[model samples]
Target: MIQNIVLGQIKRDPRSVAMANAYGTIADGYFAVGYNPAMLAYQQDKPFMLQLFGIDMGIGGNFISLQNLNSLSGDTIYAAGENPKNPHDDSKDRLFRQFDDAGGLAFRQDFHLPMPIINYSSGNMAFTSNLVWMSNLVFPIGILELLFYGNGRRPNMDMTFNVEVFGVNELGFTFAVPYDRFALGATVKYLQGLFYFGVDPDSSRANLVTSDYHLYGSGKYLFRFG
Candidate 1:
């Protein structure tokens, strides 16, 4: 497992997200702060721009969808030694098949709220701030297999899961200097980490093995905070 923190503007602008980041070249005003600060110099006519209130939110996953949720909502998963409500139901098998050999399911959610009265642009300079929150989760295929099918088919199981949640306030000052045929720009950013909570995937490990007579497994989880 690999874990790292990457700091930058990711899907912060609704227009950019809608355009699939194709707005980089024509980005202007407050939107140019991260996409391309040099584009700010092109906003000669728009002397002032202020963003009072705006919000950008996104949620996505590999195995999560409305149809999938509706299909599995009524299905019940029973514990070991417990009688299942529907013994012949294929819901469990269907759910297990959703995961591939690489992994079970991965999910991510992010929210970007531009601080009111702080996002402004004047001429070739801009000051912007945003409150950002993000979270991620992963369910390993081995764990899912063990849960649904037990360790009878696969004697050995690799159980590795990951989770991360963090929030930060990004404050930036962007400026541009235009020349005859070119422009130079820069954005100074101060990332104030509000909080961080995650499981250290590299250090966390878990495994299970089953034999004819006994089953054994061990797990260790390392959590991080800031």
Candidate 2:
């Protein structure tokens, strides 16, 4: 439904909107994978590179990248804007907490999901983030369930439980090259994220001090390619 609504808006001017969306898709590095996964396939003999970028749109954007760290490792660090709350308070602990908390996991209490794997490969895996359980399954099937409708707490769990993520979570491969432009190489890609913080608790759109208190999610999806 969200995609349908978004697509509908773009359909009004498919040409320009499509191009804009295409540019963004490319900017995200998906084009690199689509254009030539082969080029990214080679790694062992390429010079490692690190890229750092930033942006300012009344707010701000900052990012860093490490490419081809040896034959099997890489990393990236990124942060867009300083949270309005306690923006000037540069304490190490809060910064560290913000860096690790992600995927809204820090907003609510008493949320749990058994990380179950549904698919696996040397460099890729697919998993279910959500699950459904009924009390009858654990209790009784024939008991006179008088207290049936709304008899128990309907807990609202994290989105990961209901949302399905089919992604290239990890990728790696080896390629053969010749002398000069020929060599052998390999690569590895890994993915992880955490998001916290609830939606704006009140009309106050930005995080601030003394007015209210809330948790926010901070997460980044790192990409690695040689």
Candidate 3:
């Protein structure tokens, strides 16, 4: 079976969209609670700033060219699915040629809640508390090839699907301190997995909850002597 999908542009607020440039707060205003915590100390005396209900969604992939698929006419290579069991000829070759790339499809969306919950700043230290809902989906060609016999390696043309949907609810705290031309930042997060649905070729899974709870943290030091 061959599948063709076309993705669309996502819409998000400025704050959420700016998260992509979270490299090190090189742009205007101090952003990115984790990436550049130290920059928080350099901000104006706002004492508190809130981020409410911002969302981010991104799609990137070029597995197959839609133009190529649409250009074909009746009885073309992508016309219909045929039984590979009775095939031993050039028709098999045509099936492989239909898909342009068959690489993979990736999608992710982050929902920032209306909880600055702790967007407070004091002296040279900044603290932030927030929650984010994240989800990701990826369908790789290699795995699809296994399930669909797209590579024709499976003995039988039997088709199976591997659908995995992952979701995470994360609560995080960020702290930052700046000194002269040096800056330091740290972030701690508590993660709760919402769902995990997929077929594990190596193991077995009946439900979609992989991890109940998890903890993650990171620290960064920036020596900006310039």
Candidate 4:
């Protein structure tokens, strides 16, 4: 579904995810040139960096990230997406904002866990893997409530739609070799499983109709770099 596409985009892209510090993995930066940790160690000359983030639609602003980078064996490193929310704003109702029949919005004031990615070298060969997670899901209560009450207040029509399951997770792997003054690599991605969802159409709840989500695919390519 398109919802999945949007979710995947926000997850894979640094510009969109806010807390994503790793480059190359997205489009820019060199970290993504290969999936191997050994390749990253090559660039350890750069000191660790931390990013402070915040977001708010209009009234108030909320902080969301505290990340750090350091060196490790084979040039592998890890980053945690964590921060704390104030004492006041701590409820699901307050954690998220509902825009009409749209989905719920939550401010990930604190990251669930540290997203880890690693790269390593063995002789002329290198390898890398990325395991990251973020929360951008907006679950609208209005939609779920409608599932129970046919017409919570106004009801006249109904709607329903369905599509095939394509994938649930995205996995990327890279294989590379070191050459004179440079490293080269190629990646293969495997998108496994599929999930589908559709809502019924109803005029009163046109906002909660099946035609709401914007669907797209979650696929990418990997290339070599030094």
The sequence of per-residue lDDT tens digits that candidate 3 reaches over residues 1-226 is 1010221111233654457543455422224454455666676674555443344443333333466455543532321345454443444344444331432444444454434435444444444433444444444333444443443353222122234445555555555677878877665656666665555534421211112253222322222111
Tens digits of per-residue lDDT for model 4, 8-73: 222223353464434333332223333232353343433332212222111111222232112222
How big is the positional error of residue 191 in model 3, measured in Å on the Cα after superposition?
1.3
TM-score on alpha carbons, each prediction = 0.68, 0.16, 0.48, 0.28
Which candidate would rank higher by TM-score, 1 or 3? 1
Q: Which of candidates 2 and 3 reaches a greater lDDT?
A: 3
User: Which candidate achieves the best TM-score against the true structure?
Assistant: 1
Query: Over the stretch 1-226, how does candidate 1's per-residue lDDT look in tens digits?
Result: 1111432453246677678678768786888876778888888785898989988787888777888788668767544334466556565555666576436689888888999999999999999888988898888777777777777777888777889999989988889999999899888888899999999988998888898999888899999998
Local distance difference test, per candidate?
0.78, 0.24, 0.42, 0.31
Residue 27 accuracy (lDDT) in model 2: 19
Candidate 2, residue 108: the lDDT equals: 15
lDDT of the structure predicted as candidate 2: 0.24
**Lowest summed lDDT window (length 10), candidate 2:** 134-143
Q: Pairing residues by index, what is the TM-score of model 3?
A: 0.48
| TM-score of model 1 vs. true structure | 0.68
Name the candidate, 2 or 3, with the larger TM-score value. Answer: 3
Q: After superposition, how far is residue 1 of candidate 2 from its true place, in Å?
A: 15
Preferred candidate (TM-score higher): 1 or 4: 1
